[model samples]
Target: MIVWSVLIALAGAFCMALGSALQERDAVRAPGHSVARVGFLVHLARRPRWVIGTAGAGAGVALHLVALSGAPLTIIQPIGVTGLLFAIVLSALFNRTRVRAGQIAAGTAVMAGLSGLLLLFPHSAEVPQLSIGTGLGLTGAILALGCAVFAAAHWVRPGPRVLLLATVGGAALGTTSALARVVAANAAADWTAVFTWLTPMCLAAAVLGGLFQQNAYRTGHFAAAYATLLVVDPVVGAGIGALLLGEGLPTTPLNQVLAVGAALLALGGTVVLALARNRNPEALRAVADRDEPTATKPGNASPGARASTTTTSGESR
Candidate 1:
C-alpha cells in the first residue's frame, strides 16, 4: 500500500505540474482582473486550454485523494515538492529554452529543504474531530483572515501582492488538506462527520486556493509562484496538523535546527530563481499597465519595475 500510495502521489504531482503550466499559459494571456470576476469564468467555459488545465488539476486532486487513503500525510505531502521539479521541465519545454544550471540548483534546494521539513514533522495514528460548531467557527476565522490578506494585496506592490495571496492560498490549502484527512478518517467511524461543517469548509478552501493560484500564475513566473506555494502550503499544513490533528513537531534541538536551516536554504533558492531570465516580460508590462490606473492616486502609484514585452507562442506563459 505504501508503494502504491507513493506511485499514485507521483502521478498526482505530475498532473498538478502539467495543469499549472497550461493554466499559467492561458492565465498570462487573460486580461487583467478578468479571471477574478464572475464573467471570465463564463468566458473560460469556452476555452479549450483552460478547460484542459482545469481537467488536469481536477484529475490530480482526485488522484491525491486516492493516494491519501493509503499513505500518511508525512509521506505524501513531501511528494508534492516534486511538482515544482515537473513544472521546471514544463516551463523549459513550452518556452523552447534550455534550463540554466542555476535554476536546477535552485529547484534542488527547494526539494531538499521540503524533504527535510517533512522529515521533521511527527506522525500519529490519532484523528482529531471538531464539533460542527467549532468547525464552523474555525472556518469562519480562516475565511476572514484569508479575505483580509486578499484585500490587503490590492494595496501593495506586485511582489508583496503575490506573496500575500500565495500565503493566504497556502493557508487555505493546508487547512483544507488537514480537514480532508480528518473527514476521511472519521467517515466510517462517525457517519455524522461526513455531513458536517468540515465538508463545506474543505470545499470552500479548495476553491479559494485555486482562485489564488490562478491569479498568481498571471504574474508570469510559473516557477516563482509555484515555489512559494510549495513552501507555504506544507508549512501551514504542518502547523495545523500539529495543533488540530495529532501530528507532532520536532522536539529535539537537532531536528529543530535542521528544519530551520533547510527552510532558509529553500528560501534562498526561491530568491535567486525569481530573477531568472525565462520569466515572461509581457507579464511585467501587463502588471505595469494595471497599476497605471492607480498611479495618480495619492499613495497608489504605478509599478516601480520597468517592463519588457517578449511575445511567446500563443501560450503567453
Candidate 2:
C-alpha cells in the first residue's frame, strides 16, 4: 500500500510539472490582467500538453487520496514534497529546461530531512476531532492570506519574487489537509463540514495554492519555487498541528532532539535552495523571461519574426 501510494504521489508530481509547463507556455503571452479561471479552461481545451498535465493532476490527486486513506498526514505530507524534485526533472525533460547540480543537491537535502523526520516521528494513532471554532478560524485566516498573496503577487517582480505567494498557498493547503484529517475522523459527513468556514478556507487554499504554485513555476527558478512551496507549507501546517492541536512528539530526549534537528534540516534545505537560486539570478531570469510571450522558440526564429507573432498565452498563474 505504501509503495503504491508513493508511486501514485510521484506520478501526480509529474502531472503537476507538466501542467505548469503547458500553462506557462500560454500565460507568458497573455496580458497580465486576464481572468485566470477562463484562461485556465481555455488553455486546457486548446493545448494537448495541458490536457495531459491536467490528467496527471487528477491521477496525482487520486493517488494522494489513497495515501491519505492509509497513512498519517505527517507521513504523507513530507513524501508529497517528492513532487518538487519530480517537477524539476519533468520540467527539464518536457520544457527543455536545465536543473543545476546545486538545485538537485538542495532538493535532495530537503527530501533527506523530511524523510528523517518521517522515520523518527511516530504517527498519531489517536484520531483527532475537528473543533468547529478552530476549523472556522483557521479557514478564515487562510482565505485572508490567499487574497493577500494574489494582491501581493501583482506588486512583486516576476521570478523568485512569487515564491512567497507559493509558500503561502502551500501553507494554506497544508493547514487544510491537517484540518481535513481531523474533520474526516470526527465529522458525521465531510460535505456537511464544508458549509462551515473551514471548507471555503480549505478550498481557497487548495485553489490559490495551486495558482500561486503555477505562477511560481512560470516566473521563478524551478527548484527554488518548488522547494520553498513544497517544503515550507507542510512544515508550517505540521507546526500548527503539533503546537496548537497538541499532537505529541516522540517522548525520548533523543527523539525529541532528533525531531528538532529534522525541523532545522528542513529549514536549512529551504535556505540552501533559496541561496543557490539567488546566486544564480540568470536561471531566474530565464524563467521570468520565458513567462512573457516571445516571438519564437529559442533558436527557431529571428528577433524580427518573434516581434510579429500574434500568439496569445493566457492562464491564471
Candidate 3:
C-alpha cells in the first residue's frame, strides 16, 4: 500500500508540474488591467493552453486524492516538491534554452532538504472524525490568514507581495487537501453528508488559493513564485493535518528544531533558483516583460505593444 501510495503521489507530482508549467504561461499572459474583473476567468477559459493545463491540473488533483487516501499527509504532500523541478525544466524547454547551473543547484537543494526531513523523521497520519465546530474553526482560521495576505499584497513591493500571496495561497491549497480527505472518507459512507460538510469549504478554498497563486505568477518571478508555492504547500498541509485532522506529527524539542531547519533549507532553494534564473531571463521574460518593475509605463506603450507583450508563446504541449 505504501509502495502504491508513493508511486501515485510521484505521478501526481509530475502531472501537477506539467500543468503548472503550462499555466505559468497563461498567468503572465492574462491581462494585468482586468484581473479584478469578472471576465478574467472567462478570458482564460477561452484559451487552448489554459484548457489543456486545466485538464492536467484536474487529473493531478484526482491522483493526489487517491494517494492521500492511502498514505500519510507527511509522506504524500512532500513529494510535490518535484513539481518545482519539473516546472523549471519544462519552462526552459518551452523557451528553447538550456537549464542554468543555478537552477540545477537550487532544485538539488530542494530535493535534498525534503529528502532529509522525510528520512530523519517518520510521520504518520489518518483522517479523523472532525466535529462541525472544529472544521468551521479551521476554515475561519485559513480565511483570516488569506484576508491578511490579500491586504498585505497591496501594500508591499512586488517581490514580497508575490511571496506573500504565494505563501497564503499555498496554505489555502494545503487546507483544501486536508479537508478533501475528510470529505472523501465521509462521502464514502454517506454520499450526501459531505456535501454540506467540508466539501463546499474545500472547493471554495481551492478557488481562492488558485486565484491568488495565478495572480502571484503574474506579479512575481516565475521561478520565485512557483518555488515558494512548492515548498510551502506541503508544510501547510502537514500543519493542517495535525490541526484539523488530528494527525499529530513529531513535536519533541529536537524534532521541532529539525523541522524548522528543514523548512528553511527548502525555502533557501527558492533564492538559489531565483538567482540562477537571473542570468537566463528569457524563460520568464515573456511574462516578466509585462510584470517588470518600471520597465514600461502602460500609458506610454501603444495598444499594439500591450497586445504583443501579453501574447504568450501559447505552447500547448
What are the clash counts of all predictions, listed in order? 0, 6, 0
Encode model 2's per-residue lDDT on 1-317: one tens digit a residue: 77676666666666655565555454433334311332544544576665666666677777777777776666666676677677667656654656778777777887777766766655565766666687777777877886776665554544435456557757876886787666566565454754665555566556656666555554535566666766666566666667656665567999888878876777677666655533222333333234332223546866665444423221212
Relative to the unseen true structure, what is the C-alpha lDDT of residue 311 in candidate 2, on a scale of 0 to 100?
A: 32
Worst 10 residues of 1 by lDDT: 305-314
lDDT of all the models against the reference? 0.73, 0.60, 0.68
How many angstroms is residue 19 displaced in model 3 relative to the true structure, after the best TM-score fit?
1.0
Highest-scoring model, TM-score: 1
Cα TM-score per model: 0.81, 0.69, 0.76
lDDT of 1: 0.73
TM-score of 3: 0.76
lDDT of 1 by residue, 1-317 (tens): 99999999999989988987888877767765512543445555567998998899789878887998999887887786788889988988886778889888898898889888888878777766666676677678778987776666666644445556666777778777777878988997888878877899888877777777776676666787788787878888788788766577899999999989988988877766666666755565465345322333324433332222211121232
- Cα deviation at 288, candidate 1, in Å, is 6.9
lDDT of 3: 0.68
**Candidate 2 stretches greater than 4 Å from native:** 1-30, 33-48, 64-80, 155-160, 187-197, 250-252, 272-317
